[model samples]
Each structure stands twice: as structure tokens, then as C-alpha cells.
Target: MKGRVIVLDHIAGREAAALLVDGKLTDLLVDDDSAPRPGAIFRAVCDRPIKGMGGMMLRLPDGETAFLRQGKGLALGQSMLVQVTGYADDGKAVPVTDRVLFKSRYAIVTPGKPGINISRAIRDDDVRDRLLACAHEAGVAEGFGLIIRSSAAEAADEDIIEDIAAMDALATAIMADADGAPEALTEGDGPHVLAWRDWVEPAKVVTDAGGFEDMDVLGQMVSLGQPRVGLDGPAFMYVEPTRALVAVDVNTGGDTSPASTLKANLAACRALPRALRLRGLGGQVVIDMAPMSKAHRREIEGALRSAFKTDTVDTALVGWTPLGHYELQRKRERLPLPAEVMEALA
Candidate 1:
């Protein structure tokens, strides 16, 4: 399979990155330097307790709030280590976690958590066992756990060990500085880089000459592009995402062939997942596909799952609704792409 190509451009004075999968624009990212990306580690304080939700509101040094599920380890004004797991959307605060996870290209190091866990994407039992043994022999810190990412499926033992050691050292330092004022220890890559890297396999990165060179992109595309994209010839399908859910509607534009209708719908099915990823649409998503037979529906379902499996975020196919709408539930932890775009535009 050809690797996806990322096209970086400038739109409205902000850096925009467009993902091209098979020469098609699959995703778009607007570089908002003001946005706090996922995986940012910070020292935070417990400010308000939500008794009903079983999580407390934490105040980052920047004055942003994130919810912490476990409050027993925290006092009202005490500072502690937390990772920004997700951003706030639709009136919700950012999601913060006490369990700090350090991510590398090959592995994830979870401090204060023991045992080795492998990625579910790696299905081979023997490979799992081999990675398990590697983790065991890698000299893990006493309480830290190492998760073998799908990217690590072909990694050398030395690479895994080195990744663990580096992340563990960083974790140790963060823990040691827990008593300090609320502050950020490390910041993750921008939204485009973060999303691209999270894919199960690495993709080719590119940018335009006037794009974000400081971001260390691999290559450059011709120019900056628009966020909204229309595909499938004269017939256009409109895709828009909101904080609550993403809605995709298919427009045949007067095409009458049964084969043409099916072809367009199936193509839409293939395009929607990548588009959602590009837009950073998460949580509940629905696709309003052109009506088809049960067999074709099954085909679309399989295609949808296969396409979504490539996504780094955890996505659950909820089947179709009674009204023939397809449903998907994606885990929401960070700010949705539209939210960031709106923020940047504002």
C-alpha cells in the first residue's frame, strides 16, 4: 500500500496540513499554535470537585480546566502531575489524567504502572509473546509499564529498550518535580503531526515552501488547500462535523444508474472515515448513505470497518440505525478538528 502523503499549506495566515491518501484529500489540519495538543504533560491543581461525576476539575497553570477522575491523591490546592489526554469541546473541560503515559515511536511508557501490554492491532500470538518477553527483559522500572505499539511490531529489542529508558527517565523527572507550581513538562507535536503519527503505520510527511518548516515536515506539497473538499465527479457529497456528531450526506446530483449510485455510495463510505480523521471528528458520527440492498449494505459495513481500523483513535462500528443511517462511535479525548479551526479563525 502506498503511504499517505501530507500536504502542508498556508490558509488565512495559519498553517494548514492536508492529507492525501491515494491522491485524494483525506484530512485537513490548521496549525493553531495556541491550541494545547494531546499528550501534553503538566503540573496541575485540584480546583473543583464534581461529586456526581466522580472527577475533579483541575486547573492548569494556564488557567484551563481538565477533569480528573481520581481525586483521592489530590488536595484542593496541592499540585500534581497530569497529562492532557483530551481537549474541552461543547462546553466540556479538557480531560486530564494522573496516569502519565510517555509516547515514543515504538512504545508507550506508563510510569507507576507495571506489566507489559501489547497493541490490539498486533494479532499474532507468537509476536505478542515475543514482545512480552522483550518487555520483561528490557529492565523496566519498578512500577512503570510498557505498551508495545503496533508501530513496534517490527522494532528491534534495542529500540524498544531505548524508548522505554528515555520515556522512563522523563517520567521520573516529572514525578520528582511534582511539588513545583503548575507547569508544562513537555509539549507534543502540532495537530497534524499528532494525528499523522498516531496512525498504526508511519506515513510520508510533506509541506509547502511557505508552510510550517519549523515543524520538521518530511516534504512539501504544491500549495495550501481549503478545508472543505468535494469528491466523486460532478456528484458531490457534503461532509460537516459538529462537536456532538459528524453528518455526511450523499448527493447523487441526478445520476440514475444503479451501478453509478452504488459506486458513488461505496466511494463515499471509503472517503468518510478518512475525512473524519482529517477533520478530527470524534464521539458519535452518522453517515447518510444512499439507500442500497442489504448485501451492498454489508459490503459498506465491511469497508467502513476496514477503513476505520486504520485510524489511530478507538472507533466502534455501531451498525446502522432504523432509518438506514450508519452509526459510528469514536473515542473523544482531544479537541475536535473543527473546534480548533474555529478557534483559529476567531
Candidate 2:
């Protein structure tokens, strides 16, 4: 409860993984078998282009369609490899990109971009040199780029080289199949595998059966369904998802001090990223912060920036709106909790 804990378990008979930090649920991954998951590579055939949208629709072998935002130079009948970028909305085609990538725990292979790069987080000169040496040792294929992930900083040399080699080989195999018909090249990793890949922090890993119940992960997941998230003393925020956007309402509750509004707003800012991560909420976000002096805007903005700095999701803080509300645009990287899972939990 005092440190990081990774729980590999099942929810509603689906694979699920939860990360708990200091006994609080900080992140979660649940398998959703309803749609093509992000990171899945497919061989697709170009359909018709949407004139005004500057994009084209692709037909997958499984009878599903995907939308590529930049479809220039693609012929109607051309076969190409595409990767699913994110889950689609109710009536929208699945968002995809022609730029496919092969990712693993320690390395990421980029096919078009041919270069050896290291994670910017690894600033130590010796570590960078060592990682570069490992990359060179792996002997990545020509015309393919390799990225040494930050997790490789502490990993053994042999492990890093092996990971790079594995990813490079996988990319080679996948690219070789580009001449074939439209079909799924590879499915994305499930919750357990993703947990091991992305949650690289040193932690206690719990993989036994009934671990979710024993560690209260199910209870925490149930809490994610509610809108209200408690912040500091007598302060809270409600994260409500609507068709258009996710609206966050911060309140000071019963506190009436002069600095109460600013305090509550800051607390809400600190708690917001984790709340959104656990709920798997993304897209447009609008925060209706408690009314405070205009002078405190900079301070609140700084708080928000610091809060999201460590969040893994791609989020852009789009400054204050004309009406004084703050807005954010986040990538739809995770699917929202499904209804059947909630029913099963209930």
C-alpha cells in the first residue's frame, strides 16, 4: 500500500491490469474485445477518399472500415499497411495511420525513419553511450530506425540488445508481407502484457488468482464509475462525460476562507490526471474551476501543467476559454469502461 503495486487480474472474465500507488488506483487497463485495438497492424485496401476531409476510407479484410487522415497519393485499389490509432466513436470509422511502428518494452522500431535515438529522459552521458552501443550491437536492419526506451537505462546490456533485435526482426517480417491482401498482421498486446511493458517502474507484481478481490482493485474500479473525486479537505471535482466533451466541475464545498477557491482549484488540478487515466476518458475536456481572482490564473495554469507532465496520455492544455473555463484536447488512447463490465461488477 505504501509503494507501487501492479495487479494482473480479470474483470468480467476479461484480462485486466491495475496499477496502485500508495494504495490508490492510479491507472487501469481492461480488455475490450468489441473493436480493433490501438497498435494493431493490418493490411488494408484503399477505398474512396473523402474530398473535403482530405482523408480516405480503407477496407479491412474483416469487413471493417478505417479512416486515414492523411491519404494523399493513395490509389483506390492500392494495398497498404496501416495501424489502428485509437477506438472509434459510435458511428465513426476506426482512426488509423499509414505509419506503422513495432513497439516493445525496451525498443521501438520505426520503419521509414532510419536513425538510432535514445529517450530524452536518459540524460546521463555514460548511459546514452552505453545504450547506443547496445543498439549498434543489435544490428538493426538497414532503412529501419530504433529507439532505446527510457526503461533500457537500468536493463542489462544483453536484454536491451535482445529486445532491439526482436523488434527489428518483427518489423522486417511484417513489412515483407505488405505485398499480400488485406488482413490483420498482428493484434495488440493484452492487459497483462501491456502492464509489463508500460508499467516499468519497480513494483510488487501480483499475478495470483483473486488478486483483484484481495487487493480491492474491483472496489476501486467501481469507484471510477462515479463522477465525484475527492480532493483536499472539503474540496472535490465531478468528472462527467458527455457526447461533446468531458466536463469537470471543481468546488470548494463548505470552505469559505479567502483562499478557498484557489486552493480547491489547485487541488482539483493535481487530482485530475489520475482521475481521467483511471476512467479511460479522453477527447475534449473543459474544466469549470471555482471562481477565483484573475491574478491566480497563472498559478492555476502552472499547477495544471505540472499535474499532466508525468501522465502517459497525449494531452494538450488549450489555455483558458473566453468564458474563463480551461480546455484540454487529449488523444483517445484508451477505451471507456464498457457497460457490461460495470454490470458484472455491480
Candidate 3:
């Protein structure tokens, strides 16, 4: 649950912002004060004969040039429209495009840049018109253009407005050389908050042992309400895995039973996904789940899905794999849950 923010100038006159809390990228704010983009149609001009390829390197009217693949009969100064597919999510670098030679739309990804060319709305409209139309469709209010982020997919219009303003302000300040302001746009709030806020009512704070000061805020919020208490167990557990066998001893305090074991198992399953997110688990992770019951199994599965819904970054539950347990693979980038979670677990 802990993270930090960094700001830098990216676009010609815009600031690029990245928020990484708990080592995971929570927000990306770009294109706050710069020109919308080179969102226009242009004709490619033969600049110079490309050394190896037959077609010359074509210069675009918008001032970008890329090599047009040889032979398919494109000539010098040909007129056509190019749309942005995907550009750098960071606002500073503009996107690049290629002439639509194929019937299907294609994205022109520039090397060393996050440029993606989206197919234009209409082949006939001017570049600016298509850009504005796309912006309008995405609900960008003014002359400002934006690359709607993944976080905004389900947000209300107001949240989107708030985010866009945060991005705009941050970007403008970056350009004006006045950047040191505390940011209001945090690493994007994932569905976790929404889930934790909406679904899992804080039953109570569970502690691994004596350390609970780190969770002071959460504890305080739920202070008025009663929370479930589990146990203050051993410092850790050692899981032994032979080439094919893994032995896990379900160690609780003095009192351990089938019901308590199931409860602890359910609790961990419910918390594990969110905990995994909080820790920012990366790449292939094999959690040797301790065994549990059939009826309890459904509840654990449901809870796992609910907790993970809030993840802002990409993750997938392939369900339980061929192994004895399920598999959770993080996209490998970004941070996972913080260590404090493991420290705080009861």
C-alpha cells in the first residue's frame, strides 16, 4: 500500500508523469498541455532511395518519415490518411503512422517509442477532424486531446474529468518549469479500493504477531467496528519441495481444528489475491496452497476473484492448472503487494 511519484518533462511542452506506489505503476499522465497529436492524414513523399529496399523512405506532411516497404507500387508524393494506433502512453512522444495498404486496420509501432497508429475514422476526413472526433467519442471535452488510460475503462464521467484535470494540471506545470507540486492524481486506484471499500467490509484487523502499527490507518477506520481475530503464530513456515512433492504443515497456535483450519484457509485465500497485488508479485508464482474443504472451496474461489477485480494492472486467473493447485501469473512488470502485508498477516 506504499508508493512514490516522479515527474519529468516529456513532450515538447508537456510534462510526463508516472506514479509507482508499492513499486507498481498506478498511473500514467501524459499530453496535458501539448498539441493534441499529429492526428492527421498525410501523403508520403519519396525523400531518398532506401538502400536495401526498392521503395524510398517517405516523408510525411506532419513532419515524420518512415520507410515504406518496397514494391507494392506506392509512388512519390502519394496522398492518403494515416491514423494513430498507439503512441507512447507517456504524452511526450507523438505516434507514427503508415499508409493503410491492407483492408484491415493496423497499428504502426515505432521502435524505441510507444507509437501505435490507429486506423483513421474516415479515410476522407482531415487529420485534425479525425483526431477531434476520436477525442469527442472518448469524451474529451475541450480542444484537449488524450489517450484514455486503461483505468478509465469503467470510471464515471466525473472520475474521468477529475483524472483528466489532474493530468492536465500536472502536464502544464511540467511545461512551465513549475513542477514540484504534490500530486492529486495518485497511482491509479485499482478495483481493490472499490472492492475493499464496497465488498469486504473490514471484519477486523488480523495480525501475524505483535506488529500492527503499520496498519494504523486501516485499524483506525474500522476501530468503531469489531473485527475478526485469528492468531499470533510462529515467525514463519518452511515449505519442503522435492522434485515433485511439497509438504506443508498447517501450523496454528495451540488450538487448531478442522473448522479453524478452514476459516484460516478461507481468510488467506480471500486475502491472498489482494495481498499478492499489494506485494506486486511478478512473473510465474506457484503458491503451494494448504489443503481445505469442498464447501469452503467455493467461498475461497469467489473471494479470490472479488479481491482481484480491483487490480489496475493486467492479471489473469487461468483457474487451477494441471498441477494440484491453481496458478496465478503476474504480467511480470510492475510491483506486487508490499512486504508489510506478510508482516501484518494474522
Per-residue lDDT over 254-297 for candidate 1, one digit per residue giving the tens place of the 0 to 100 score: 77777766777777776776666655667888888876776788
Candidate 3, residues 22-73: lDDT per residue as tens digits?
A: 5443333333221222223233345565557564555544454544445246
The estimated TM-scores of all candidates read: 0.76, 0.98, 0.34
Candidate 1: give the clashing pairs. Answer: 27-278, 86-333, 87-334, 206-219, 207-219, 207-220
Sort by lDDT, top down from the best: 2, 1, 3
- Tens digits of per-residue lDDT, candidate 2, 1-346, equal 7999999988788999999999988899999988988899999999999989899999987789999999889999999999998888778898999889999999999999999999999999999999999999897888999999999999999999998888999999998888667899998888898998899999999999999999999988888788999989999999999998999999999999999999999999999999998888999999999999889999999999999999989999999988999999988888888888888788
Model 1: what TM-score?
Answer: 0.76
Cα miss at 41, model 1 (Å)? 1.5
Q: Which 10-residue window of candidate 3 scores lowest in summed lDDT?
A: 100-109
The C-alpha stretches of model 2 lying farther than 4 A from their native spots are none
- lDDT agreement with native, every candidate: 0.69, 0.92, 0.37
Model 3 clash tally, residue pairs? 31
Best by lDDT: 2
Deviating ranges (above 4 Å) for candidate 3: 1-253, 321-323, 335-346
